[model samples]
Target: MRQLRRLVLMAVCSTLVVASPTRSLAREGVTQQVHEARQEGSVWTAFAFNRHLSPFSLNVDVEGSVATLTGTVENEVKRELAEQVALGIDGIETVDNRIRVDPGVRPRLVSVAAVDERLDDATVEARVKSKLLWNTRTEGLDIGVESREGLVTLSGESASAQARELAGKLAASTEGVERVDNAIRVTGEPGTVARAQSEVAQAGNLLGDAWITGRVKTRFLSSDNLGALDISVRTDEGVVHLAGTVATAAEKELAVETARNVRGVLDVQAASLKVAG
Candidate 1:
């Protein structure tokens, strides 16, 4: 009886040992399938975006169940359509679309050196300003314009949100603008006290953003180290968004510091500023 009991215990132990490994192996297989499914979803998303948005440069990166779409597309429709295609993929859990719209430029194959060889910044700025001035909606507004590497930045104060949006559209639709960062603030709401916070006042200080923008632009023009025309500066309620390219790293640093030192500038953001190689 003792031998029989020992034999039964041993048999049970062996069964458990064998079944445990089998279960672990099955789980690993499932995990691998999930990973492969995510990869497949990313590839399919890319194909769909490319098929639909052939004229735009779009890239997809997938991790686990999340898909991130990056690169530049032409216009808003293409940008939205790329996001939709990524979301439609079966295994994707989320889609982070960071694709920007290049209204004046189309997708092309070129080297970084070639990018630096494109249209001059001064010409691009003039074209953008002309377009904005011709547009009846944005005409007569003191919109501070700056261009760098075909990207235009419009800084000033608009009468309303609609006018601000219209100014951005005009800049983007210009002949030389590859992208536009419309930092024009809408007046009549509140005065920009801090970078993000604004306090309500008695129907006064409506042109606060415009004042800051003009001051910053004047400082840039006066500075010997910074090329005001090569850099685009936009002041949105005292927060300065600098876009465009500079000659060197030193110039970039000077530009940011200059913007920060401005009397009314609350903060300086240079994420859009790219240095020429």
Candidate 2:
């Protein structure tokens, strides 16, 4: 009976360990703790005190200690100061610095701040929309550009998924883009999502690409290092190339299918792709 009882206890322990969702719980707990530790009021006080920053020109929006700082500053230096102050506080979890700079500091910003510093609101919107329509990837054009203030808001439908995401990122990163409101949706083609999803992901991924191989492991399917892997993307010339060694033939087809969905892709070249694994 003693030995039997020990076996039963061991089985119960194993079951409990398996059933409990500890991995997910631990991640959530850590995120929550970070939020709790970073309180808003404390960050605000820090923002107010920093010599390089001033609360008078800053706006703070806080939720459960997470802070988003948005407003206008005179120049790039002041804009950075605002972020530094908010994050310097020990308990603050996050800081979003969305501040606009004066045109005097940078001519491009003078043409892009959301508030009209130069032209009428209607005129600004028209000009921005016209630009989007001209771009191949920005087919579904919904643009709101306040020329007087030079703040641009873009929304609409694109023929391809890659277009929608690239248009937004391009606008956001533009020299004249003071504030980019990306409302573009991915629709219009069969394989649209696949092509655009990867590129959109790459926009952020390329910044710190070394981190990806550690996280999203490559599952190769073929003998050739390049084959068996799936890669489909629209080139600058508007051609789609499907390359990679896959572990199986099914993966090769799936990769091709993924490329076919992108809007404005001339054609998917799958001859270069192979499957092995």
TM-score of every model? 0.28, 0.24
Quote the positional error of residue 58 for candidate 1 in Å.
46
Total backbone collisions, model 1:
0
> All candidates' lDDT scores?
0.59, 0.45
Worst 10 residues of 1 by lDDT: 195-204
Model 2 ranges with Cα > 4 A deviation: 1-38, 103-277
Please give the distance, in angstroms, between residue 54's alpha carbon in candidate 2 and its true position after superposition. 2.2
- Which residue pairs does candidate 1 place in steric collision? none
Native-referenced Cα lDDT, model 1: 0.59
lDDT tens readout by residue for model 1, 14-129: 66458788634543443343343334333432443244564454556655677788888778887888877777766777888898887886666543233223214433554455
Q: Which of the numbered candidates is closest to the native, going by highest TM-score?
A: 1
